[model samples]
Target: MSAGEELRARLAVALTRARDRSAALTECVDETELVAQHSPLMSPLVWDLAHIGNQEELWLVRDVGGREPVRRDIDELYDAFRHPRAARPALPLLDPDEARGYVAQVRDKVWEVLDRAPLRGRRLERDGFAFAMIAQHEQQHDETMLATHQLRSGPAVLTAPPPPSPSWPPAVGAEVVVPAGEFTMGTSTDPWALDNERPAHRVALPAFAIDAAPVTNGQFLEFLDDGGYRRPELWSARGWEHRQSATLAAPQFWERDGAGNWWRRVFGVLAPLPPASPVVHVSYFEAQAYARWAGRRLPTEAEWEKAARWDPRTGESRRFPWGEGEPDSGHANLGQRHLEPAAVGAYPAGRSPLGVGQLIGDVWEWTSSDFQPYPGFSAFPYREYSEVFFGGDYKVLRGGSFGTDPVACRGTFRNWDLPIRRQIFAGFRCARDVVGA
Candidate 1:
């Protein structure tokens, strides 16, 4: 196929895959569940359903193709900035059937734009960036909707085969030493990378050791047994205040049974905590407190990126932990193929050059850095996407979780949220400075 033909084919696949995943997420739940706000932190599933279609229409049909608006009157209704999640159910949202039809109509228009456009000249059209952006946007909402599913009160509706078993026995608390060096931090050439992850720059650091894998439930249980949450010294002043005010005892969705064993609810199914799996649904404060209790610290964002992407053998960075190749079923627990995190060391093939395992998926590893811009960062197309959110208020998270799709998750992809927020599938690992390095 010609270059243009190849690009079109890839964009078509990405867009179709996103839509398929969106359908699975919404269809599994009934209309009442879709319309209900599962949590204050998440929009109603129906809102996400229509919002994805609206964003596709706005960015592709109007901005890129310069076509007439599909439904101009509803723009403000679906505007995420205008309506918060808690307020969205009160708005005049398209019901499930209507949302399905609207998205289908918008997608039909998108296909026509794809068929006729030259995919060149304009920056958004170059390399089909706008199309890819829409696909990623839809996939992001798919993840958010999945989170809502976890929050809703219902009996097990979502299910997936458990993640693959580890090929070799995992060294539970093993650490990998990342030697001191300068390595490229972000991407300048990745065609689909968002603005915040642009303009690759050098970040120098001294030697440090990061966990071979994310901290697991068993390890976290040790902290709980030792009164990690009650010991104010283990938490930051702000974290302690939030912990007390919120009565944060364990990860969200977790409770102790009368037998004293911990069980957690996953997508409405209550099960015993899988000790070997990386702990999920944790806030930065919880992760940080655990790190402090362990006498370690969360790795800086640069440190986490360096460990995930840096290739000491070549003194260069890779597009992913495993290399330049895109993720697959064998690589990591991504794309909702599995509903929860895999046992640590499950994907040996996904390990980085430094032998750090499961860095790409399983759980979003919390880092100790604030969301910030790269040295030469400049917003493209718009500022609301990344520029508006940059600051110390948000903590940077590296790696994607089991709920993330491959199109939206990568080594350099950045996800940030308020440090105390915990509804998302997040987890963490610890790092300690190499003494006398």
Candidate 2:
């Protein structure tokens, strides 16, 4: 195949992968469940179903293909900025069957555009960026719908095999030192990287230590045992206030039996907590308090990126933690292959040059840095995607989660959310400064 043909083939596969996953997520439930707002934080599954199609129609059929809008009447109904998740149910939305049909129609138009549209020239078409962007957007919403499934109170409807056992356990309290120096952060060459992660720049830093693997459920249980939540000193003032108001005790979805043993609900299946797996469904406040109790801090975005991407041996950065290679099942727990995080040290192949394991998948790791633009950032296509969300109100998260699709994730991939959001799959690893290095 020619180079352009190859690009089109990859884009088609990415789009198909995203759509298949979306079907799996939304097809398991009945229409009532699809229309019900499982949580105030998440849109109804049907809304997401239609929203995905709407976005595809807007970007691919209308914008890129230069075609008349497909169902422009419903554009405002699906516009995320126009309505909050809590209010979506009240608005007239396409039913499950209608939504499925609508997305299928939109996709038909997309494939027509993909077959003939020049993959080069215009900025949107350059390197097939627009197609990739839409695919990523759909996968992101699929993840959101997966979260809604997790929040739904029902019998277990989704199932997957457990993640593989680690070849060897990650040592207790293991950390890898990133020596003081400069390393390139973000990316300028990544054709599909979103605006927030653009314009690669060098970042200088002093010596510091980061966890070799993400903190596991066993370690976090220790924090809970020691009154980690009750002690005010262990939390920031704002964190403490939110903790008290939200009645934060354990990670969301956790339940304590009369025997006082902790169990958690995963996709509607109640099971005992796995000590070795990285803890998920935690908020930034909870992670921060846990770090404080452990006498460490959350890694900043730059610190996390450097640890995940920098190659000390060669004085350069790698595309992924292990190297410049696309992720596979053995490399990381991604793409909903497993519904939960694998045990730390499970994917030794995925470790960075500095030996930071599980950095690419499992859980979205919270960093100390607030969501902000990198130096020389500029919005393309639209500003609502990233520019509107840049501020201190949101905290930066690096690395993708088990729910994150590969097309939407990379070392330079940036995810952010309000600090108190715990419904999403999020976790953290601790870091400490080295005074003299």
Candidate 3:
């Protein structure tokens, strides 16, 4: 296919996927459920629905199409920075029916703009970046809406086939050694890469060992059994305070039966904890404490990147752990293919060159590094997408979770959350410096 044809095809697929996922999530619940704020941490599902439409109108219809705003007055209603999520329900926001119609109208105009716009003329339009950005934005909200579903207390309204059963036994070696070297740490040429992932730079690091797979539920149970939560020394001062304040005893949604066996609430269904799946819904503090309890440390962002993307033989970075190919069912457990994480070591085909498994999906793996910019970072389109979040307060998360759409995820893609957030689909793999390597 011609370049424009290829871009249009990809854009069409991404847009369709984003819309479908959003619809599926919203349609599963009644209007009351859509309007209810499931958690203070999240906007009402209906708000996300309308907000997705507003953003598309802003970026694609107005910015790219040069059209007059359809509902310019409503922009502030959806301005995420202008209104916190908790207060969004009180705003005069579009209801479910109105949101669907509004988004449909905006999407119709966006399609017309996409068909005729010179895809190479302007910075935002160049290489179809604006279209990609909107697609990514909508997919991100879909993930957020999914999180709201997880937090909502109701019967399950979502369903998906379970991830493939493991094809290989659990990894025997707990950790893989990454030799000391300089590795390229970000992307310089990826057309749709966000600003933070720009200006790929060389990062030199000492030899280290990282877990072959994420720490599993059974393993984390051992930490809990050993008083990992009660022992304050295992946590950072801030982490300990947060833990004590929240009275966190285990990962979110976990409960013990009268028999003392562990069960977890998954999409409103209480089931025995899948011992082999990577532990999810844990905060950064919990991950750090677990690393300490295991006599290891969380990998720095650089170390985690090297393990997942760097190819020692080529001395170059691969777009993904497995290769430059787009993610598919064979590559990773992503795109809500499974409502929960697959068992660790299930995706051997997705392993990195150095043998790291499930680096692209399953759960967003917490890294030790703070979320910061690259050497020559410059915000594009807007600063809020990433630039504003650059600081020590937000811990960096690499890899995507099952809730993450493939169009919105990449090896260099960065996700960040506060250390105390436990509602996100996050987990961690431990790393330790190789002494005297």
Candidate 4:
């Protein structure tokens, strides 16, 4: 295929996957569910649907196609930062049917733009960056909507076949040692990488030992059984206070049945806790507390990246744990193929060269580092994407979750959230300094 044809093909695949995922999220629910604010933490599903279309129209149709705005009046209504999610349902927002029709119209225009536009010339059009950005953006909202589905109380509205059963031996709680050295962090050449992952730079690190896989539910349960939450010394002052205020006994959605067996609610269905599966819906404070209870610490962003992407044999950084290849079903559990995380250590083929497993999917792994910019960071397209969130307030998360789409995930992909937030699909692996290394 020619250069432009190849770019077009990639963009087409990304956009198709994004649109399909978004449709799946909305189509499964009734109109009432779409408009209902499941939680104050998320926008109404209808709002997300329309906002996706609006963004595509603004970027692909108006900017790329050089066409007039289709609905200029509602632009501010969809501006995510302008209004909090709790207030979204109060606005004169488009209903489900109207939102779907609006998106369909915008998509038709976008396809027209894609057909005739030169995929080369302007910065946004060159190499199809803008198209990829929009696809990623839509998929991100799909993830957010999935979170809403999890938060909403009612019957199950979505269903998907489970991921392939584990074929590899379970991780035996072994820790892999990474020697002290400098490895490249972030991405410089990845065209679709956001501004936060830009300007790849070298980072020096001390020798450390990291868990081979994410901490599992069984492991975390042991902590809880041992009064990990009750001990003030095991938690930071802020974490202890937050735990006390929230009265958090276990991970969100988890409860002990009348028989004293652990169960968790999954998309409105209550099921027994899978002992081998990696724990999800954990906040940074919970992760930190678990690490402390285990006499380890959460890996620094540099440490986690090095363990996942640094190849010791070549002394080079890879795009993913399994190397430069695109992820497949054999590699990792992503793209909502499974609503829940696969059993830990199931994806041996996706393991890093150093034998670390499940570094890219199953759940987003929390890191010790704060969300900050690279040394030579520069915002592209807009500042709201990354600049506004660059601070110590938000903790960094690496890897992606089962709800995440492949187009939006990479080894260098950065995710951040408030330390106290537990609604996200987040987990962590413990790390510690190597003694006498």
Candidate 5:
């Protein structure tokens, strides 16, 4: 088939996927309902949905291409990025049906124009890339919205977890004794990575004993029982402040019932906390606190990458704990059933050379390092992604969440956010500088 036909086919599939996502999210986001409190992260369903429409339609189809938008009237309707949240109300907006129509119109136009069009035009790729980016943006918001709906409101659907994941890595209990080595950390890329992952650098390190598995809820519960939260000495000042302010009694989704039984929200369903499951939805603050409480700390980004580094010639150690490939059901709780968080240790094949449980995708492990750009780092085409936050407030987060796009989980892909945010699908695994045996 010609490149043009291929583009259409690809575009068709992509649009269909986005549309499917909208349908899947229908149960999660109800425009008529009041926005939940835990979701201070977003403006409103209308705002977000409309923003998607505007971004997909106007930003990609017309503006970036130097063409006029199809709907002149809707140009500023939901342009929340350019028109900030404070200014969002001033612009006329669309209801769900209208928003969908706007999205469809843009999607149709994008497909039509690109079908037989030149890929060489700066206008097309520039605009097309925007849509690609917009799609990613939507996905990020989608997971957060789901998390907020459950945390701030109530569980979307109450059901038992589907059951332990049927798939498991072949080497159930393998060990990757990663040698102590110095390596560059953070995303060392000239290409576009989020600001948090930029300014990669070389760091020296000594040997350390690294865990092959993520710290499970069962393990973390022990720390909690041992006064993980109450002990001020175990927390950073910032972390303590967050704990006291939120009055956090446990991990974000965990609840202690009248009977004192522990339950956790797993993909809109509440069930008894799985003993072997990796504790998820814990924020950076909480992760830090837990690490200190356990006499450990979050791994440095350097330590993480060095251990996972692969030397193909040596075959000595696996660079990717699960081998050089994308994650599947056998590797991590990433793109698959979409029903629930799998049990920790469910993906043995995906384990790093060192024995780590659920390192790749079950949850986003919080790292101790502050989110900062690497030395000699420069901004990407979009300046806002990395340059704005170089002052060092954000914290580095690692691994990938269950629903994170596999392509987005590259080792260099840096994720950062406020420490107190526990409503997202982030979780942490503990690390420490090597101590005397």
Candidate 6:
């Protein structure tokens, strides 16, 4: 059909997907699925739904109908964006059905504006983009809510870790080394690169070897068996302090029974640790501790990217090691696979130029560098994109994890979490400098 029809069709499809996602999220009732964060606007499913719904109206309604903005009271009712530490925006507190109706109303208006007569308004572009962004944002929260539902709703004490996939992109324990070379680091082009990863520049490298595969639960267990966590020397001073205060004997989700066998959770299922599965749900601190115990170190963001880059010599700065392709189970353990982290090195076809496997999924590999912006970096459409953290003491992690969206996993895509957060699906791979005489 016509260009307008195509745009309408696109918007219509997005709303339909959003509706389906929203319906699934409806199951997250009364904190069964979604544990409301201390701040309501952050994790309360109610706050998320209301917030996204209001966003649609704010962005699309004026264009579709001659509608004035949402009422000020309504804005206050679900305004979670303004204050970071504020309590969850007090919603109208409608029952689920009523809330769904309100959301549907906004979605319907959006479809109408997108589908009907061609028009050019700055607000159209502005709200259209916002609508899309919020819709995607809500979908992400939808997944988390599902896990939260299972986490809090059931008396489900996790007894074991999830089962691992049998094979990965490469054989277990494969290794690769690259000769010294200079390469550009970070994103040089403007195509959805995060600000912290932008204003890309060049970096020099020396010859070094990297693990072809991520560290496995089985391997990490060796460190644990050797009292890795107990040894103060195996940990950074901060890490040692954290370990002492936390008193964790194993990975965050891992536990051993009288049998001394490992078990943990996958998505929602519990099973034993797959010997070959990349260790997951560990935090940056734990990863660092493990790397020290294993006589290795985590890769720098620059070093990690250099080896993980698609074209070793001259590949485009990609969102993933596998290039621009969106993630799927076959390519990576992202999206709603219900499958947990796969066996390490399973997707050889998706391996990095240096034969580093599972660089985009299985787990978010820890990086050695602290999170910081690049040269000439500028915030994009949203100021919160990067300016908030000029010198924020956050560490950078790369290679999206099992729960990540494919779109969220790019070479230039960076994620940050306090080192102490071990609940997220994070793990680490090691890098070492070859000894120089």
Every candidate's lDDT: 0.92, 0.94, 0.93, 0.92, 0.62, 0.66
The better-scoring model by lDDT among 2 and 6 is 2
> In each prediction, how many residue pairs overlap at the backbone (N, C-alpha, C within less than 3 A)?
0, 0, 0, 0, 16, 19
Determine which window of 10 residues in candidate 3 has minimal summed lDDT: 165-174
How would you encode candidate 5's per-residue C-alpha lDDT over 1-437 as one tens digit per residue? 97556654654555566556654654445556423233545554555655666666655576555556777776555544576544554455676677667767776777665554454456335334444555556666555545545554544642233535535532322334455555656544323244455666666677665556677778788888888889888888988888998898798779888997899866556779886667877888788887777677778766666655433245333324566565666767764245456666577667554555676776777777777767777764366766776666788777777766654565666677778877667777666665442
TM-score of 6: 0.82
Candidate 1 lDDT: 0.92
lDDT of 3 at 272: 96
Query: Candidate 4: lDDT of 162?
Result: 75
* TM-score per candidate: 0.99, 0.99, 0.99, 0.98, 0.82, 0.82
What TM-score would you give candidate 4 relative to the actual structure? 0.98
Evaluated against the true structure, the overall lDDT of model 6 is 0.66
In candidate 4, residue 90 scores what lDDT?
Answer: 97
Please give, for residues 1-437, the per-residue lDDT of candidate 3 as tens digits. 98889899899889999999999999999999999999999999999999999999999999999999999999999999999998999999998999999999999999899898888988899989999999999999999999999999989989899888888645643789999989999998999988889989999999999999999999999999999999999999999999999999999999999999999999988999999999999999999999999999999999999999999889999999988999999999989989999998789999999988989889999998999999999999799988989875999999999999998899899989999998999999999989777
Model 4, 1-437: lDDT tens per residue?
A: 88888889889899989998999999998899889999999999999999999999999999999998989999999998999988999999999999999999999889889988898888788888899999999999999999999999989988889776677755557889999999999999988898899889999998999999899999999999999889999999999999999998899999898888999999999999999899999889999999999999999999999999999999999999989989999899999999999987688899999999899989999999999999999998899999988975999999999999989999999999999988999988999999667
Residue pairs clashing, model 3: none
**What is the Cα-based TM-score of model 1?**
0.99
The root-mean-square deviation over C-alpha atoms between each candidate and the true structure, in angstroms, is 0.9, 0.7, 0.9, 1.0, 4.2, 4.3
Candidate 2 local Cα displacement, residue 151, angstroms:
0.2
lDDT at 399, model 4: 96
Top-scoring candidate (lDDT): 2
Pairs clashing within candidate 4: none
